[model samples]
Target chain A: MLNQLARDVKASMSIYDAGDDKVYGLLAEFAHPGELLHAAEAVREAGFRHFDTHSPFPIHGMDKAMGLGNSIVGWITLGGGITGLSLATLMQWWMGAVDYPINISGKPFFAVEPSIPIMFELTVLLASLATAAGMFALNGLPRPYNPLFYSKNFARVTDDAFFLHIAASDTKFDRDATAQMLEKLGASNVETIHDHGVEDQD
Target chain B: MSTASTDKTLAHLADFHDEAPLVKGNLTFHDITEIVSSHTEKKTPFAWYGAFSLALAGLMLLVGMIAYLFWNGTGVWGLNNPVGWGYAIVNFVFWVGIGHAGTLISAILFLFRQQWRTAINRSAEAMTIFAVICALVFPTIHVGRVWAIYWTLPLPNQMNMWPQFKSPLLWDVFAVSTYFTVSLVFWYIGLVPDLASMRDRAKGKLRKLVLGVASMGWTGANRHWRNYEKAYLLLAALATPLVLSVHSVVSFDFAVSIVPGWHTTIFPPYFVAGAIFSGFAMVVTLLVIARKIYGVENIITVDHLEKMNIIILLTGTMVGFAYITEFFIAWYSGVQYEQYAFVNRMFGPYAWAYWTMMSCNLFFPQFFWFKKLRRNITFMFIISIFVNIGMWFERFVITVTSLHRDYLPSSWDYYTPTAVDVLTFVGTFGLFFTLFLLFLRFMPMVAVAEVKGIMPEADPHFYDHEGDGHHAEHAVEPSTQQ
Candidate 1:
C-alpha cells in the first residue's frame, strides 16, 4: 500500500522521485500518553510552536503542557459583586430609609442590621451573573462552526480514541520531513489528513 | 499509547464478554435507555401504583379540608385569642422546617461534598418546594383576612395604608418568598437534565409530551453539561447563605419583640439549628419510606441514613444547647418579666405543652447515639414523628406560655384551640401528604442520572486495567456544594 501511494503521490506532484519515494508527515500511529508527553516536549524543544492534541478524555497537567494559565473570571466576579452590593444597598436605602422614612417602629431609617441579608443576597446574585457572562465570553461559545469540525474522524475524540495533529501551515513545514519526524517520534499509523475546506491562503 | 494498547489487549476478552467489566467505557445516546430501563422493563410492581393512588385519594381529603377553611372564616378552626396561630403556625413552621433538609441536602450537603446525598437530594429538593407550599398556606390565612392581607404590602391606595416595615411579619414575607424562589429555580434547573433523560426513555405520547416540555430543550451535549455545572455551582454558593439568612429572619419575628419569652437573642441560631435538625430527620423519614416503596434500597444505603442521623443528632444537640442558653440568659439578665417568662414556661398553665416540646425535640433524638437505633427503621420513624410533635409544642409554649401571663395579668388570657384549630391543623397535614403523594407518582422520585454519575463505574477514564482499584484517594470528591 505504501509503495502504491508513493508512486501515485510522485506522479500527481510531477516532481522528482523514482523508487522508494517516501511521503512526509503521515501519522504512523497514536501515541501513548507518556509518549505523547515526550513528543510534545520534543516539539517544543525543536522550536515548533503550532500543534494540537485531541483526546477522548482530558488529561491532568494538559494545561501546563499547553502553556495555559490563569483565568480572568475571578476579577469579573469580584467587580460584578461589588457593583451588585452597591446597587442593592443604594436601592434599598433610598427607598426604605432615605426617601420615605415614615416612622413605623420608631427605629432609625438606615438600620444596617436589617439590610445585611439583602446586601448579601445582591452581592452573590451579581457575582454569579458576572461569572456566567464572563465564562461565555472567554469560551467563545455559540460559534456555530469550528475549524476542528472539518475533520470527519475528529468526532471519535469524544468516544474511544486519542489523536495529535500537526498542520501544514506550520513555519517548520516540509511535508515529507515533518511526517518522517512524527513517525520517528512514535505515532501509530502516520497518515496525512487533508483539510479540504481550509482557505486558499497565498 | 503503547501502555494503553497493551492494557486494552490484556483485558479485551473481559471487556467484550464480562457482564461486569468494572467500567462502561463509552455511552452513546442509545446507551442511556439501556443503562436506566433494563431492570425496569418488565411490568412495574402494579402494587406500587395502586398504593400511590390510594395515597392520592388521601391527599384529596387535605384539599377538601383547605377548601372548607378558605370558604368559612378561620373561625371554622378552633383558633381564638391566644391560640390564634395554633396548628396552622405549627404546621407552617413544621412544613418550613421540614423543607430545610431538602435544600440542605441539595446545597449544603453538596457543598460539604457528600456523594451519598446524590440518591436522595433530588427528592429532598422536591420536598423542599412542597413543604414551603404547605408552610405558606398557614401564614396567608392565619391573618383571618386572606384577601385584605394585601393591605400589609406597601402600596398607594384609597385607604392610605402601608405594611408595618418594622414588623417581623413583614420581613417573613420577603424571607420565605425569596427562599421559595431560589429553591424552586435550583430544583427545576437540577431536574432539567433528568427530565431530558426521561424524555429519551419515553415510549408513549404521555411520557413524550410531559418529559419533552419539562426538559426545557436539553440536548445532552458536553458543553451544556459544562455550562450547567458552573451555573449549579453558583446556585449552591448563593443558596448556602440564603439558607442561613432565611431562618434567622424568621427567628427575628420573635427575637426582636420585647414580649417576655418571645424576645431572646438566641432565637436565630437556635431556630436555624432546629430547622436543620428537624429537616434532616424529615429527610430520613421520607427517604426511608420512599426507598422501601420505590424498591430503591440499594441506591439509598444504610450509610446514607447513618450520615443523616448524625446530622439530626448534631443539630439536635445544638438545639438543646440553645434551650439551655436561653434559660440561663433569662435568669442571668435578672429582668423580672423575662425571669417570669422562663419560670412560667416550665410550670405555667401550658407546662404539659412545654414538657412535650422538651422531650420530643431534645430527648428522643439522643437515641441516635446508638448506631443500631439510627439505622433501625421503625424507631427512627417513631422518633421523627416525635420530633415533629416536640417542635410544634416548642412553638406553642413560646407563643402562648410567654404571652398568656404578661406584665399586666388582667390583660392576659388563657389560649385554647377550638375544634376549628384541630381540624385546620389536620388539614395542613392533608395538604402536605397530598403534594408528596403526587410527587412520588409523577416524578422520578430519585435522581437516576446523579446516582449513575456518582457510581465509580461511570469514570472509566480513570483506569487502564479493569478493576485496578488504584483510585483509593479519589475520596468521592467529598460531597461539595449541592
Candidate 2:
C-alpha cells in the first residue's frame, strides 16, 4: 500500500547527458519491442545500469529486456486460496455442526453434498480476494502521485509511445554515454526531466 | 498460413494506439470524447430507444400485473386446485433458463480461450443479473399469501415458523444469490481494466472522478496484469461448475418429486440443455441488435453469431433428444401413470402447447444448419425469437399439461392464464430490456483494453524496424513446470 509517489520519492533523479549536449537518450520512446531490447543492450554496452523501459502494453520479451524475473502473483493467489478454503471449512463446520444442529430429511447437519455450495463459494471468494490484495501489494498500488507526472509528455504513454528512463543511481550511469545510446536507437523525442526535490512537493 | 496468421494478428494489435496525426491507435482522449459525447449520448436515435422504451413500458405493465395478482391473490392467475403454478412458473423457468447463457459465455468461454466472446460478455453478464432478478420474482410471488413471504428465511422473529430446509425452494434461495453475487463480481473484475482505460482517457472532472475510483487505481503494471489474468482464470473455473449447479438445483425442485410427468430422470440435463439453448438464443437476439446499434461490427462479427447459432442447434438437438427420450422412457417403463402422462401430453387437453414447444425448440433450430441462415442476421434474429417462444412453450408443456391431467381423472382440471398472467409475462420482458439498454448506454460495452491487448498488430514487433532484439530475449525458456 505504499503511495506510488512515496516510493517514487526515494528514486534519484535520472539525468542522461549526451557528450555533445544533444542529449537524445530517454529510450522509453521506442515503439518496437525489438528496439527496446537493443536499447537495453546499448545501455549495458555503454555501461549504464539504471534504466527502465515502459510501454502501454507488455511486450513479449520486455521482462528479459529489463532483466526482470518471476512475479509473486502465483504465490499470493495460492496463499489466498488456502486461507479461503480453511476459513470456509471452519465457518461451515462451526455453524452447521457445533454451534447449532439442524437436520433436513434425516441428512447429516454437515452433509458434504449440501455444504459443497458453501465450500466452493468460499474457495472462489478467498482466491479472488487474495489475487486482488496480492496484486495491489506486488504492484505497490494506491500510490497517489508520482514525479513522473511532472513530465506531462509521460502521459502520452497511456497512448502509443514507449519509453525508457536511465536513473543516475545506476552503477555505470554516465549521463552522456546513456543519452548517446538512446539517440542511436531511433527515439522519437527525448527530454531530460529534472527533480525539484522533496521540499518543493506540497 | 500459420506464420501469416500470427503476423496478421500481431500487426492488427496496434491499430488503436495513440501515435498518428489524429491520434494513432485505439481510443485516445479525443476518441473517448467523441464516442461518449457524439454517439453514446447523442439521444440514442429516438426510433431505436423509442423501441427500447416501448419494451420497457411493457415491462412496467408486467410489473403492474404482478402487483394485481399478488394483491388479488393467486386467483387472479388461472390457477385452480390442481394447477398451482401457471404463467408464473413458466416465466420463472423461462427467464432463469435464459440467464444461463451469460455465465456460460463468460466463464466457459474464458476457460476455453475463446477470444471472440469479449464483444458480448458484458451484455451477457448483465442479462444474467436481470434475468435472475426476474426469476426471483416468481417463487416469492407464487406463494399466494404474499405478505408472509419472509417466512422462508430463518430469523429471530415473534413466530418460530422455521423455513422448510427440506424444501427445494429454500435451496433455490441459496443457489441463486450465490450465482448472482459471484457472477457480478466476475463481471466487474473483467471490466476493471477497461474502466481504467476509460478513466485515463476521460477529459472532464466528473468523468475523471467517476472513472478513476471505478478503475481502482489501475496502472496496468505487469504484476497487476498477471494477477488480473489469474483471477479471471480462477473465476472462470469457479463459474464453470456454478453454471451447472444453478440449473441442476432448480431441476431438483421437480425431479426429486415422483410426479408422473415431472419425475423423469432426464429432466436435469434436459432442463439444463434447454436452459442453455434458450439462453444462447437470447444472447444471439441481443448481440445481433446490439452490434448493429453499437456499431461494433468488427468486434462482434458474423462469425461470432454463426458460432452461437451453431450452439443453439447443438443444444436444441439435445433438448429434442430429451423430449423424445422422455416419451420413450415413459412408455417403456410401462408404469401406467407415467404411460398415461406421456400419451396425455400429445393427445391431451393442451396438445397445442406440447406441439408448439416441440416445433419452437426442435424445428426452428434446424434451419441454422445452413451456413447462410446461421450467418444471416435477419433470419438468425427471427429464429432466436422463435427459440425463446419455443422454450417458454416447453416450460408450459412441462408444467401446465402435466398438471391438467394427473393420475386420477376426477381431480383433473385445466390451467388457463388470466389477464394478469399474460401481463406479468410481458412485464418481465420490459424489465429485462430496460436494464440491458441502459447498460449499453453508460458502460464500456466492449472491453477496449482487452481487445487491444489481443491484437497481434498492437505488439511492437509488427513494425518493420524492431524484431531481432525482442526475439533474442523471448528465447528465455518458459518455466519448465510442464
Q: Write the per-residue lDDT of candidate 2 for residues A1-202, one digit (tens) a residue.
A: 5854453433311222232433323434664444655676666566655466654555655555555556666677778778867876666566556655677667776656655555665566566667656655655555544444445556544444456777655556556666666777766566664444232232
lDDT of 1 at B434: 63
A1-202, model 1: which lDDT tens digit per residue? 9976665433221111211222222232343343444555566566654455544333433444544344455677778789978986786677677656677557777677777766666676676667656544444433333334344444333332345565444467566787778777766555564434452232
What is the per-residue lDDT of model 2 for residues B1-482, given as tens digits with 9 covering 90 to 100? 12333434334443443221111233332243234323443555776678777877977797788778766888778889888778888888888899999999898987776766765687788889889888888888898888877876555467534454445676666677668777787778877766665666667788778877786665544434554566677768877887787887788777777778999778878988998999999999998887787766656778778889999999999999999999999999989999888888898888888899899999989999899889899999999999999999998888887888887889999887887888887787788888787778777776655554444444445443343433423221111110
* Error at A12, model 2, angstroms: 18
Report the number of the highest-DockQ candidate. 2
Model 1 misplacement above 4 A: A1-88, A121-202, B1-67, B70-72, B82-84, B151-164, B465-482
Best by lDDT: 2
True contacts kept of 1: 0.03
Candidate 1 residue-wise lDDT, B1-482, digit = tens: 12333234334434323222212333322233344343333455677567666656656666676677778877777655544446676667767877888888898877876667777887899888988988897888788777887876556677654444456777777678768877887887677656655555567887667776776444333333444555667678777887887888777877887788878888888888888888887788788887787656666667677778888888888888788898999999999999998898888888899889889888899999999998898888888888877877777787778767878876767877766566656666666666676677666666655665444323433333344523323222211111
Chain A superposition TM-score, candidate 1 = 0.66
lDDT of each: 0.64, 0.69
Give residue B155's lDDT in candidate 1 (0 to 100): 64
